[model samples]
Target chain A: MIITNIETVPGRTIVEHYGIVQGSTVRAKHVGVDCVAGCQNTFGGELKGYSQLLEESRNEAMDRMIKQAQQLGANAIVNVRFGTSMITQGASEILAYGTAVRLE
Target chain B: MADFLFFVVFVTAVFFIGQHIQKKHFASLEAREQALLYLPAVVGRKVFNDDDVERAWLVHGTVVVSGDYFKMMLAGLIKFFGGRISAYESLLDRSRREALLRMKEAAASEGAHMVVNVRFETSKIDGGNPSQQTTGMFEMLTYGTAIRLKAQ
Candidate 1:
């Protein structure tokens, strides 16, 4: 499905709107990854493990949102947005939401 | 006495090493930005259509950056004085630029000419209690729709 973070997808017209669809997931890294990240923190560099974990979780959230839009018979999603929050110490919740619409 | 000595040595090492790494990162970010200057990324929300557009799709980049203990402690001291914590400024700037550059690179890799409606999401990830530890880090995510024009 076509997705854009604007009101309308480029080169496409929205013929119908299906309101808002959202998906969210909370995730954390394994102990080993966390330990590695902790060691890397001392030198102040990129935390690859955390980055990968968060990106994967974000993709999963977007996938769920896209599935919801697909179920709504929408060919595209627009005005998409992402949200993140720490649920606990290590776990974080990633959210993807957007308006589902049919394009012509 | 040994504990205090170790603390001083560790802080000194982090200060010099962290500053060096940050300078290197900035230099690399500048070089990459110049190389990718041809690809325009904009945050305009208004929709505009180009008749020559061939395809459009969403692209994103994510980065997690950490701060050294020296900066973290400096920020703490500044907090007591109720002034700006400038030490963390570079950390934030570095991550934002890195994330945006990565997004532009992704669009370029897809052979897209431009990225529009760019949005950034930033969040702190301490991984544990903030007061108990001196660690500081954040994640930055930038995304937009990459547009490829029809070849003439």
Candidate 2:
């Protein structure tokens, strides 16, 4: 699908605002990874572990948001945005939202 | 001398255990990417209620990173590996996913089956100070069109 962050897609026109649609997910660190992360901190580098976890969560959340929009039968989403909340010291949540609309 | 020898062995064992745990942790994270297939499909659809026939929407993404512990660590790792600073992958991935969903929703709403002329852009939202925080915050954005698939 055509995706962009710009307010307007060059060739397409936004028809109507379908209100706000969103999807989100929360994640916590497991003991296995936390223990290792604690030690890995000593050497201090990219925790490929945590990074991948975040990536997975983000994708899931986005997918859900898209489904919600589809259910609404919007031809496009405009002015889309993402927000992240640190739920706790070891956990965080990612949210995706956008304005659903029809395009010509 | 015997006591010293036993202490050394114990310490060695603990060290190995820690290493093993760390290795396992890394392995688990790597395994996560495998389930990526089950991730939701990105889709968006829109219908123009107005008379304008040239419907279009803009999709763009920006990667914002604030200064923090995680940001520094990531930067250090990139430097250590002689790799370019790509601390924005997380943001990019997030944006891309969101943008796709938005597009899908828009398309589905308009009874469109596909989107076209997809494009992407990246930018910085905030340039936080490294001295002020332990980690950095950044953003990535993605946007695109939701179009009807041409009739077969």
| Top candidate (lDDT) | 1
* CAPRI class of candidate 2: incorrect
State each candidate's chain A TM-score: 0.97, 0.87
lDDT of 1 by residue, B126-152 (tens): 654456563856899999988888888
Question: What is the TM-score of candidate 1?
Answer: 0.94
Worst 10 contiguous positions by lDDT, candidate 2 chain A? A38-47
The fnat scores of all predictions, in order, read: 0.64, 0.11
lDDT score for candidate 1 against the true structure: 0.86
Q: Best candidate per DockQ, number?
A: 1
Best by TM-score: 1
RMSD of each: 1.7, 11.1
lDDT of 2 by residue, B21-108 (tens): 4456446545643433332233333433323333333322222222224435557678777866654443344434544544444455
TM-score of each: 0.94, 0.45
Model 2's i-RMS, to one decimal, reads: 10.1
lDDT of 2 at A38: 46
